[model samples]
Target: MNLALAAAALAGTPNDSHGESISQGVDSKHILVSQAQDWVAEDRQLQKSTIEVAPSDRRLIIPVCNTAFEFNYPFASSQKTLRAVCPSSGWQIFLGISVHQSDNALRYTGNFKAGHQLTGTDVELASLSSAIAGLAGDLRAIEGFSLASAVRAGDLVMQRQLVTPIEGYRLNRAVAAGEIVESSSIDSILIASATLSAGQTVTLEQLDGARAARDLAAGKVLSSYDIKKRHQVLITQSGIPRGHPVTRANIALQDYYGKLPNDSLQNYRSAEQMQAIRNLAAGTMLRLSDLTPIDIIRKGDNVQLSVRAGALEITVTMLALENARLEQRVLLLNPESGEEIQAIATAVGQARGLSTVAR
Candidate 1:
């Protein structure tokens, strides 16, 4: 049988975790060939070979050696002679080796534009014997990732060729301190900021200290610019009434551009489900200390009331007589009885009160 082919067939045979043969090395020649296969680089594989092992040599026990046994190459680059060395026993055997080029590679099935995200459909397996430098061997690693560079049909997809999508806010133009960054001058850039040739991501903290180091031109990619620390202020989109829940609808984010007092919402999520402590006019810049969380019950607002008595729990609708936050005492008016009672604000528009008959 062909030596390299014999080695491949025997090498693939299932073995235990420690690589002990399930067949107990019953086929000694095959086991010896399989041992030589391990020396080949992952990128290369043995093809065909002529191995000569003496009948007397086959019976000799070789102790495991920590160093690798050298395989001698005697012929052209495609063919070799592998010699297994037993350093402890001082024994050596020469085996004629023949090898063919092998490659685990990826080939593009179709053309893709630069900056395009690579999909599974764009790639397919290449021939195993066709080795290409820098080619990717695993499809799972590259699929769904974007290519760092473009590729043509039949082009090789290599490691480090794909990138993860970047998502964040990018500045469209530069600004001086205390100047409000206009909407037209900034946008969300999904590409990585490090590779960005034109934009810089603006964080809420950056808004506090951020400013153009000097005059910056429009269409300038932000990644290269330096920004001082700053707080991105939330601007009132519309006039916000006192006690009104602050939402995205009524507020917009803005970066400080000039020398101004530091005041703004640091987190975009903070605006969600929050209420204004006082009335804010349209376009008013917001500060972290300016707004409070929404009150659970508000004055003149309709609220659901839960009354607990022993095992009986009753739910009734009532009007709030005063504004209150969670767990705060608030006065609730019974619309039908025209009487007010004390209740604890529990949740938004929800309150808990003691059961009482109308007085």
Candidate 2:
């Protein structure tokens, strides 16, 4: 391929045709320019630009190759030597162009508080500056974030200045002082079981179960007082003997002053079976601490033991050595072998275990 011919082919001016004789069907210059534009547009780093591409003023003519045209460099950009080549032709030409960004990156529309979550309307594109020179012109880079410090209007919002918004609970409407904070008025929640105290965070479930202990302003963060702590206790209608099951009929709601356990009296309202640990007089508050779970198997009682090993299960009558609750492990004496084996109490008077040698 002749250098003169390559110059002639690339020449934009028609009067200075040096190698016009070279085969010219498709405009290789135009194709190279188009390919160069595409290269810049597809570039991951250079895509954010307004590229102005123009053919060089010099003339060059080269043999048109059968293969596709390509750039000698991996990328094309402004003020860079864009070497377009026809691989099969073994020739290439250089062009000079410019890539410019039309505007600055992120600019604030108005003063923003430090904790305010950034939104699309809060910022807009403006002239590019060194402050935001490295930042991309993307809303996603800043949206949903808050400012690390207060930003004045028209200030450049830098990526380093932005921070992820911290998640917290807030009220949707004004809550009266001492009014119960309901689920409907809360924007977010945290789960907890304690009574609301002043400045102590409370969850919606805890609030829904309690009344406002004091006057609480609307939107004010809830404290311990926002939640009423009184809980209903199972009271005794009559003397409940030790080991006797406590039913709802014998209990009533009463204000409790102490901290309740995770398994609070609220659980017994569903009518779950619980028994007294010791004898209690009539009207005694049936605290959970004073109650023991019902015994499914009693001491010295004859119970059927389901001795199991993998898939095989065998039944043997055994005498329980001690009282056991549901799923409680109990010692049983296998009468036939005269051996005491440990078995889990499953049902009333029914125990199951794996067979073991007498000990």
Top candidate by TM-score: 2
> Candidate 1's residue-wise lDDT over 1-359, tens digit each?
23432111111323344335423444445555666665544225334332332323343333334445555444445444556664444545656544444466788998886556667888887776555666688789875577677779998787766777565455676666445445566676555323544345545445444555556566554442544444466788899888778888888887645444655565678676577888899988876566877777779999899988799998889999898988888989999888777888989899999544465
Choose the strongest candidate by lDDT: 2
1-359: candidate 2 lDDT, tens digit per residue: 00111122433333434455333523655566667777756753555346555554434443455777676542434335456666765655665546655555777899976666678999887765344355646777876677767888988777767766533455677666445556777666332222232356554546664655656556655555455754665556788888788876776666554356654465455435578778889977666777777888989899999877778988889999899988989999978778998889999889888546567
Task: Please provide TM-scores, in order, for all candidate models, with all chains considered together.
Answer: 0.33, 0.55
Model 1 segments more than 4 A misplaced: 1-28, 38-81, 85-90, 109-113, 119-122, 128-134, 140-145, 149-154, 158-167, 170-195, 198-204, 207-359
TM-score of decoy 1: 0.33
The 10-residue segment with the lowest total lDDT in model 2: 1-10
Model 2 off-target regions past 4 Å?
1-35, 42-103, 126-136, 160-174, 182-210, 219-242, 247-260, 263-274, 278-290, 297-346, 350-359
Per-residue lDDT of 335 in model 2: 81
| CA-lDDT, candidates in order | 0.63, 0.64
